[model samples]
Target: MSAIQALSRQLYQSKLPWTFEFNFNEPDYIEQYWTHLGGDLTFNRPINMMSLPSHFIHEPLPGASATLATISHQQALQYMSAQHLQQSFLLSVHQYLMQNIQNNIQLEHTAEHFQMSSATLKRKLKKHQTHFQAQLDQSRLHTAIHLYRVHGFKTEQISQYLQINDTTNFRRAFKRWSGLTVQAAQS
Candidate 1:
């Protein structure tokens, strides 16, 4: 396998979030190759690196020359660590929303925190196949599940924690998310 293919496989198998950086300019064929394998590519100017989510299928690029560069194992590990720290921007935004789930999370608030305009944030999320409200619903559902299962919180408590005004709405939303009523989930 080529280096990029091998690296992509390793990252996917490890199940850790990562961003791949290529030193040379990514030819159009390379981009197409990755895209066909369900990878999203973001090009960085001056750096010649392509950032993508970790869960991508790697296919060999047609007519690609295999140029192997020998590197120490420790250097490879360090490179992997750096890549893990550079997760997709959309994921970082989701994580930020998850951390602030107790408060009323808003797109404007998240955008300001990320130092991007609200439109830019929306565009980025859209590129990643999600929207602000969708992410909020996901975060709330995740938090609700954790509180319900781990802390034994009741529906009312979860609703309050999530800042939902009505427990009935919370129940409905929870059922929609998990296909089970809160009480049903608890039992």
Candidate 2:
């Protein structure tokens, strides 16, 4: 089962209303849930409806028992397909970076990681209409946004994680990727 489906199943098994903040329709809903959970967790980032399904299993009812349940096979297949695509994109980007971002690193390392020649990798990326730099920039932007918003990390830390020299470029690039500044992106 996909993360979201597993979460939904856990929610149903707990016999609790699927609830928590980040309900896209209600800005204040998540804060209240965090309060009820006796902690200060917050979905400080801008909430989107598509992200809701991922959290359903996280808020379990107290005094509830877990149960094994089944979902429709067709729905399961569809969920798995979407999940596989997401995982593939994430893993490829991650592995590509891991093998290519060391000192004097090169694209040839990324191609080697994929067990293909650099030329083949280039051709495949062209067919997809994307380049490695674009994907790397996107991955960095996504990670920076998440860390800054969710963990309240500073710009310097974010830049460091992205393996960039300075925070200024990180800030400028972040603002370009996300309309909000890093400071503003939090909450």
Candidate 3:
């Protein structure tokens, strides 16, 4: 397995919460990481008040001054709140993605229009403790909940509008986001 995958797997399996810091100065290590991990992972400082995933963030490892890094999850909720705040970079991306998704525009196209390199965008979102997949899913969930409860769109039509090809993924993501089924949310 690649180092990033190894790191990710270890992160998921770790029982305790911690933030991890990355050593970004070493071009070789950073290059290998991006190479192995597909350019989505990077050590970057997030925007104001943003936080990172618990597994991949922490204070700099002791005396490791070449590059500061950490491994912790304490900032996870902070990151979530930051992402949810209005006009955050993720929110901007989310709004743009939603507008385009409604028009059937591709994610790559949306990423490009925003002047974000795919890797940079992905890493920034990751630093904020979510993935593009999750953000897109959240956008769809926002639509689903609104239509089901507030706007009164039918499930099938909502599914079509949201571009959720698989009914199962829609249902699963809805429950994951809202702690209730779509139908339950409507009622």
Which of the numbered candidates is closest to the native, going by highest TM-score? Answer: 1
Q: Please list the residue runs of candidate 2 whose C-alpha ends up more than 4 Å from where it truly belongs after superposition.
A: 1-10, 13-58, 61-91, 94-105
- Model 3: lDDT equals 0.60
* Model 3, residue 130: C-alpha shift (Å): 1.5
Better-scoring candidate (lDDT), 1 or 2: 1
* Model 2 lDDT, full chain set: 0.58
For model 1, residues 86-172, the per-residue Cα lDDT tens digits are: 767867876998899988788899999999999999998889898998888777877886786557788889999988889999988
Ranking by lDDT: 1, 3, 2
Which runs of model 1 end up more than 4 angstroms from their true locations? 1-85
lDDT of 1: 0.68
lDDT of 3 at 23: 22
- Tens digits of per-residue lDDT, candidate 3, 1-187, equal 3544456546455322223323233355566654554444424211111124443456433334342233234366567677884467887878887776676655567678878788877888889999887777677766675566446788777878877787777777677765667665553
Q: Using TM-score as the measure, name the better of candidate 1 and candidate 3.
A: 1
* lDDT winner: 1
How close to the true structure is residue 80 of candidate 3, measured as C-alpha lDDT? 68
Off by more than 4 A, model 3: 1-86, 103-107, 166-169
Q: What is the lDDT of residue 107 in candidate 3?
A: 54
TM-score of each: 0.55, 0.53, 0.48
